[model samples]
Target: MSTVGRPPGRGTDEPVGDLVSRASQQISALVREEMRLARAEMTQKGKRFGMGGGLFGGAGLIGFLAAQASAAAVIAALALLLPVWASALITAALLAAVAAAMAAAGRRQVAEAGTPAPQQAIDSVKADVTEIKEATHR
Candidate 1:
């Protein structure tokens, strides 16, 4: 369905230049397709990433409120006969545990995502360069 791959002056007995032009056009089309594929892949990932970030933000907001409420509870417990430092120490430990869990989860997500954009772009560019070089030499 692509006329671009047809050598120039096809019916008129084309020369080598026509062949080169056709090759170039085919290479161009291949590059465009690769680029389109890359963009679509990244766009889909970006949308999922956006949604995940929104959910994370909402969760973070709720967690912050809960921590604040815990701090208030700690203060009330201290006022009612619980030792102040003991309450604060317990709250601090709880916050540290939560922070460690969140950090570990975030790191796992980052590792799973890998180098999506840059690695794909690099591979595609390398392929295009190799194709162009071969086309030119032929």
Candidate 2:
């Protein structure tokens, strides 16, 4: 079929080679456009994530300062009834106890977590392989 001088249309008879070439080019263009769109979206999301992370860091610093102020207030309150050195020592002891308790709890949690390997997935894959082998034998 001749497609010469005919404007491209669905009804126009065209060579198979020309149609395949056009389809290939269209697919390539479509993929490139999709990649470009994905890159742009990721870039925008990355910027937002960075800004959010920075804000969270700032908030964390402020929270740390607040905690320090609170600790100082506790020491000052104790100092009203006791000597300054004694009050500071008591505060330090209390903080140390809290730290020890937290560390112990963290260690317990880590122990409870067991190994980091994906045991369930490994077992599932093993089961699948066994099933496949059994089927092949059958």
Best by lDDT: 2
| lDDT scores in order | 0.88, 0.94
Error of 1 at 34 (Å): 0.9
Regions of model 2 farther than 4 Å from truth: 1-11, 130-138
Name the regions of candidate 1 deviating beyond 4 angstroms. Answer: 1-14, 82-138
Cα distance off (Å), candidate 2, residue 83: 0.8
What's each prediction's TM-score? 0.48, 0.84
Give the lDDT of residue 81 in candidate 2.
Answer: 100
What digit string (tens of lDDT, one per residue) describes model 2 on residues 21-138? 9999999999999999999999999999999999999999999999899889999999999998999999999999999999999999999998899989999999999999999999
Give residue 29's lDDT in candidate 2 (0 to 100): 100
135 Cα displacement, candidate 2 (Å): 5.4
Q: Candidate 2: lDDT of 120?
A: 95
